[model samples]
Target: MYTLNANEAKTKFGAMLMKVQSEPVEIIKNGSPVAVVVSLDEYNKIEQLKMELVKSRFENIDESDLVDGKTFREELNAGKYD
Candidate 1:
Protein backbone atom coordinates (compact mmCIF):
# COMPACT_ATOMS: atom_id res chain seq x y z
CA MET A 1 0.00 0.00 0.00
CA TYR A 2 1.03 3.56 -0.70
CA THR A 3 -0.28 6.79 0.83
CA LEU A 4 -0.38 10.31 -0.58
CA ASN A 5 -1.47 13.61 0.87
CA ALA A 6 -4.35 15.50 -0.77
CA ASN A 7 -2.09 17.96 -2.56
CA GLU A 8 0.29 15.23 -3.64
CA ALA A 9 -2.62 13.22 -5.02
CA LYS A 10 -4.10 16.17 -6.96
CA THR A 11 -0.77 17.27 -8.45
CA LYS A 12 0.23 13.69 -9.25
CA PHE A 13 -3.12 12.31 -10.26
CA GLY A 14 -1.93 10.86 -13.56
CA ALA A 15 1.04 9.09 -11.98
CA MET A 16 -1.19 7.72 -9.25
CA LEU A 17 -3.67 6.42 -11.80
CA MET A 18 -0.91 4.45 -13.46
CA LYS A 19 0.43 3.15 -10.19
CA VAL A 20 -3.03 2.06 -9.05
CA GLN A 21 -3.14 -0.37 -11.94
CA SER A 22 -0.63 -2.53 -10.07
CA GLU A 23 -1.58 -1.73 -6.46
CA PRO A 24 -3.87 0.41 -4.33
CA VAL A 25 -3.08 3.97 -3.25
CA GLU A 26 -4.58 5.50 -0.12
CA ILE A 27 -5.36 9.20 -0.25
CA ILE A 28 -4.89 10.99 3.04
CA LYS A 29 -6.55 14.20 4.16
CA ASN A 30 -5.33 15.92 7.32
CA GLY A 31 -3.17 12.86 7.96
CA SER A 32 -6.17 10.53 7.88
CA PRO A 33 -6.93 8.09 5.10
CA VAL A 34 -10.03 9.22 3.15
CA ALA A 35 -10.09 7.35 -0.12
CA VAL A 36 -8.56 4.45 -1.97
CA VAL A 37 -7.58 4.28 -5.62
CA VAL A 38 -7.58 0.87 -7.21
CA SER A 39 -7.49 -0.57 -10.70
CA LEU A 40 -10.82 -1.39 -12.35
CA ASP A 41 -9.87 -5.07 -12.40
CA GLU A 42 -9.07 -5.03 -8.69
CA TYR A 43 -12.25 -3.12 -7.83
CA ASN A 44 -14.40 -5.50 -9.86
CA LYS A 45 -12.75 -8.51 -8.27
CA ILE A 46 -13.42 -7.12 -4.80
CA GLU A 47 -17.07 -6.40 -5.58
CA GLN A 48 -17.56 -9.89 -7.01
CA LEU A 49 -16.00 -11.51 -3.95
CA LYS A 50 -18.18 -9.43 -1.62
CA MET A 51 -21.30 -10.45 -3.49
CA GLU A 52 -20.31 -14.11 -3.30
CA LEU A 53 -19.70 -13.85 0.44
CA VAL A 54 -23.08 -12.23 1.06
CA LYS A 55 -24.80 -14.86 -1.04
CA SER A 56 -23.12 -17.69 0.84
CA ARG A 57 -24.02 -16.22 4.22
CA PHE A 58 -27.63 -15.72 3.20
CA GLU A 59 -27.76 -19.33 2.04
CA ASN A 60 -27.62 -20.38 5.69
CA ILE A 61 -30.65 -18.23 6.60
CA ASP A 62 -33.65 -20.56 6.60
CA GLU A 63 -37.05 -18.88 6.19
CA SER A 64 -38.55 -21.58 8.39
CA ASP A 65 -36.16 -20.57 11.17
CA LEU A 66 -37.02 -16.91 11.01
CA VAL A 67 -36.88 -14.76 14.16
CA ASP A 68 -37.60 -11.11 14.96
CA GLY A 69 -34.73 -8.71 15.65
CA LYS A 70 -35.31 -8.94 19.44
CA THR A 71 -35.46 -12.73 19.44
CA PHE A 72 -32.40 -12.89 17.20
CA ARG A 73 -30.49 -10.69 19.63
CA GLU A 74 -31.59 -12.83 22.58
CA GLU A 75 -30.45 -15.98 20.82
CA LEU A 76 -27.09 -14.37 20.00
CA ASN A 77 -26.70 -13.24 23.62
CA ALA A 78 -27.44 -16.79 24.77
CA GLY A 79 -24.68 -18.11 22.46
CA LYS A 80 -27.10 -20.50 20.79
CA TYR A 81 -25.05 -20.68 17.61
CA ASP A 82 -21.93 -21.60 19.56
Candidate 2:
Protein backbone atom coordinates (compact mmCIF):
# COMPACT_ATOMS: atom_id res chain seq x y z
CA MET A 1 0.00 0.00 0.00
CA TYR A 2 1.23 3.50 -0.85
CA THR A 3 0.48 6.19 1.73
CA LEU A 4 0.16 9.88 0.96
CA ASN A 5 -0.68 12.78 3.23
CA ALA A 6 -3.65 14.94 2.28
CA ASN A 7 -1.60 17.79 0.90
CA GLU A 8 0.68 15.59 -1.16
CA ALA A 9 -2.29 13.68 -2.48
CA LYS A 10 -4.01 16.88 -3.53
CA THR A 11 -0.90 18.30 -5.18
CA LYS A 12 -0.09 15.12 -7.08
CA PHE A 13 -3.61 13.88 -7.56
CA GLY A 14 -3.14 12.92 -11.20
CA ALA A 15 0.02 10.91 -10.61
CA MET A 16 -1.52 9.26 -7.56
CA LEU A 17 -4.50 8.25 -9.66
CA MET A 18 -2.19 6.68 -12.20
CA LYS A 19 -0.44 4.72 -9.44
CA VAL A 20 -3.81 3.37 -8.36
CA GLN A 21 -4.22 1.87 -11.81
CA SER A 22 -1.59 -0.72 -10.89
CA GLU A 23 -2.47 -1.12 -7.19
CA PRO A 24 -4.41 0.47 -4.36
CA VAL A 25 -3.39 3.85 -2.93
CA GLU A 26 -4.18 4.73 0.67
CA ILE A 27 -5.04 8.24 1.70
CA ILE A 28 -4.17 9.28 5.23
CA LYS A 29 -5.58 12.19 7.17
CA ASN A 30 -4.11 13.23 10.53
CA GLY A 31 -1.84 10.17 10.41
CA SER A 32 -4.87 7.83 10.19
CA PRO A 33 -5.81 5.87 7.11
CA VAL A 34 -8.95 7.36 5.62
CA ALA A 35 -9.69 5.99 2.17
CA VAL A 36 -8.51 3.92 -0.77
CA VAL A 37 -8.52 4.38 -4.54
CA VAL A 38 -8.61 1.53 -7.07
CA SER A 39 -8.59 1.31 -10.82
CA LEU A 40 -11.75 1.22 -12.95
CA ASP A 41 -10.80 -2.21 -14.23
CA GLU A 42 -10.88 -3.53 -10.67
CA TYR A 43 -14.14 -1.74 -9.99
CA ASN A 44 -15.76 -3.14 -13.12
CA LYS A 45 -14.56 -6.63 -12.27
CA ILE A 46 -16.31 -6.36 -8.94
CA GLU A 47 -19.47 -5.09 -10.63
CA GLN A 48 -19.41 -7.97 -13.11
CA LEU A 49 -19.03 -10.41 -10.23
CA LYS A 50 -22.08 -8.89 -8.55
CA MET A 51 -24.08 -9.22 -11.77
CA GLU A 52 -23.02 -12.85 -12.07
CA LEU A 53 -24.23 -13.49 -8.54
CA VAL A 54 -27.59 -11.94 -9.35
CA LYS A 55 -27.78 -14.00 -12.51
CA SER A 56 -26.96 -17.16 -10.56
CA ARG A 57 -29.97 -16.52 -8.34
CA PHE A 58 -32.18 -17.01 -11.41
CA GLU A 59 -30.24 -19.89 -12.92
CA ASN A 60 -32.71 -22.51 -11.76
CA ILE A 61 -35.76 -20.69 -13.11
CA ASP A 62 -37.51 -22.46 -15.96
CA GLU A 63 -38.41 -20.58 -19.17
CA SER A 64 -42.10 -21.51 -18.73
CA ASP A 65 -42.12 -20.10 -15.22
CA LEU A 66 -40.52 -16.91 -16.50
CA VAL A 67 -43.08 -16.42 -19.29
CA ASP A 68 -46.18 -17.68 -17.58
CA GLY A 69 -49.36 -16.16 -19.02
CA LYS A 70 -47.66 -12.87 -19.85
CA THR A 71 -47.69 -11.10 -23.20
CA PHE A 72 -44.55 -9.20 -24.27
CA ARG A 73 -46.33 -5.82 -24.25
CA GLU A 74 -48.05 -6.58 -20.98
CA GLU A 75 -44.76 -7.38 -19.34
CA LEU A 76 -43.10 -4.37 -20.94
CA ASN A 77 -45.90 -2.04 -19.82
CA ALA A 78 -46.01 -3.43 -16.25
CA GLY A 79 -49.62 -4.58 -16.76
CA LYS A 80 -48.86 -8.32 -16.63
CA TYR A 81 -50.46 -8.79 -13.21
CA ASP A 82 -53.79 -7.44 -14.38
Candidate 3:
Protein backbone atom coordinates (compact mmCIF):
# COMPACT_ATOMS: atom_id res chain seq x y z
CA MET A 1 0.00 0.00 0.00
CA TYR A 2 1.07 3.60 -0.61
CA THR A 3 0.16 6.27 1.95
CA LEU A 4 -0.65 9.92 1.52
CA ASN A 5 -1.92 12.57 3.88
CA ALA A 6 -5.20 14.25 2.97
CA ASN A 7 -3.60 17.37 1.60
CA GLU A 8 -1.17 15.45 -0.55
CA ALA A 9 -3.92 13.22 -1.81
CA LYS A 10 -6.05 16.19 -2.77
CA THR A 11 -3.24 18.05 -4.53
CA LYS A 12 -1.80 14.96 -6.21
CA PHE A 13 -5.06 13.18 -6.94
CA GLY A 14 -4.02 12.33 -10.48
CA ALA A 15 -0.73 10.78 -9.39
CA MET A 16 -2.44 8.83 -6.62
CA LEU A 17 -4.96 7.49 -9.11
CA MET A 18 -2.12 6.35 -11.34
CA LYS A 19 -0.36 4.62 -8.43
CA VAL A 20 -3.53 2.72 -7.55
CA GLN A 21 -3.41 1.01 -10.92
CA SER A 22 -0.55 -1.10 -9.58
CA GLU A 23 -1.31 -1.12 -5.83
CA PRO A 24 -3.75 0.23 -3.31
CA VAL A 25 -3.21 3.70 -1.78
CA GLU A 26 -4.00 4.59 1.80
CA ILE A 27 -5.40 8.04 2.55
CA ILE A 28 -4.97 9.67 5.93
CA LYS A 29 -6.55 12.71 7.51
CA ASN A 30 -5.46 14.43 10.74
CA GLY A 31 -2.89 11.68 11.27
CA SER A 32 -5.60 9.02 11.17
CA PRO A 33 -6.20 6.53 8.38
CA VAL A 34 -9.46 7.22 6.56
CA ALA A 35 -9.67 5.45 3.21
CA VAL A 36 -8.09 3.21 0.61
CA VAL A 37 -8.02 3.73 -3.13
CA VAL A 38 -7.85 0.60 -5.28
CA SER A 39 -8.07 -0.16 -8.95
CA LEU A 40 -11.48 -1.13 -10.38
CA ASP A 41 -10.10 -4.59 -11.04
CA GLU A 42 -9.17 -4.98 -7.40
CA TYR A 43 -12.54 -3.67 -6.25
CA ASN A 44 -14.35 -6.10 -8.53
CA LYS A 45 -12.27 -9.01 -7.27
CA ILE A 46 -13.15 -8.11 -3.67
CA GLU A 47 -16.84 -7.92 -4.49
CA GLN A 48 -16.66 -11.29 -6.25
CA LEU A 49 -15.02 -12.84 -3.21
CA LYS A 50 -17.77 -11.50 -0.97
CA MET A 51 -20.45 -12.94 -3.24
CA GLU A 52 -18.75 -16.32 -3.32
CA LEU A 53 -18.47 -16.41 0.46
CA VAL A 54 -22.15 -15.58 0.86
CA LYS A 55 -23.14 -18.22 -1.69
CA SER A 56 -21.06 -20.88 0.02
CA ARG A 57 -22.59 -20.09 3.37
CA PHE A 58 -26.09 -20.26 1.93
CA GLU A 59 -25.32 -23.61 0.32
CA ASN A 60 -24.36 -25.03 3.69
CA ILE A 61 -27.64 -24.11 5.27
CA ASP A 62 -30.30 -26.75 5.94
CA GLU A 63 -33.85 -26.21 4.76
CA SER A 64 -35.02 -26.41 8.39
CA ASP A 65 -32.88 -23.36 9.15
CA LEU A 66 -34.54 -21.29 6.45
CA VAL A 67 -37.07 -18.55 7.18
CA ASP A 68 -40.01 -17.49 5.05
CA GLY A 69 -39.92 -14.02 3.51
CA LYS A 70 -42.69 -12.49 5.64
CA THR A 71 -41.32 -13.87 8.89
CA PHE A 72 -37.85 -12.74 7.99
CA ARG A 73 -39.14 -9.26 7.18
CA GLU A 74 -41.05 -9.12 10.50
CA GLU A 75 -37.99 -10.12 12.44
CA LEU A 76 -35.91 -7.60 10.51
CA ASN A 77 -38.36 -4.81 11.29
CA ALA A 78 -38.21 -5.78 14.98
CA GLY A 79 -34.49 -4.98 14.92
CA LYS A 80 -33.44 -8.61 15.06
CA TYR A 81 -30.64 -7.87 12.62
CA ASP A 82 -29.39 -4.89 14.58
- What local lDDT does model 2 show for residue 79? 69
Tens digit of lDDT per residue, candidate 1, span 8-72?
A: 99999999999999899999999899999999999999999999999998889888879899998
Q: Taking the tens digit of each residue's C-alpha lDDT, what string does model 2 give over 3-48?
A: 8988889999999989999998899999998988889998899899
Per-residue lDDT tens digits for candidate 3, residues 1-82, read 8999999999999999999999999999999999999999999999999999999989879988899999999999999999
Hey, what RMSD does candidate 1 come out at?
4.1
Where in model 1 is the C-alpha error above 4 Å? Answer: 67-82
Model 2 off-target regions past 4 Å? 57-82
TM-score of 3: 0.81
TM-score of 1: 0.74
Better of 1 and 2 by lDDT: 1
Clashing pairs in 2: none
What is the Å distance of residue 69 in model 2 from its true position?
24
- For all candidates in order, the CA lDDT equals 0.94, 0.86, 0.97
Candidate 3 lDDT score at position 33: 99
lDDT of 3 at 66: 90
- Which candidate number has the best lDDT? 3
Using TM-score as the measure, what is the rank order of every candidate, best first? 3, 1, 2
Q: For model 2, how many clashes?
A: 0
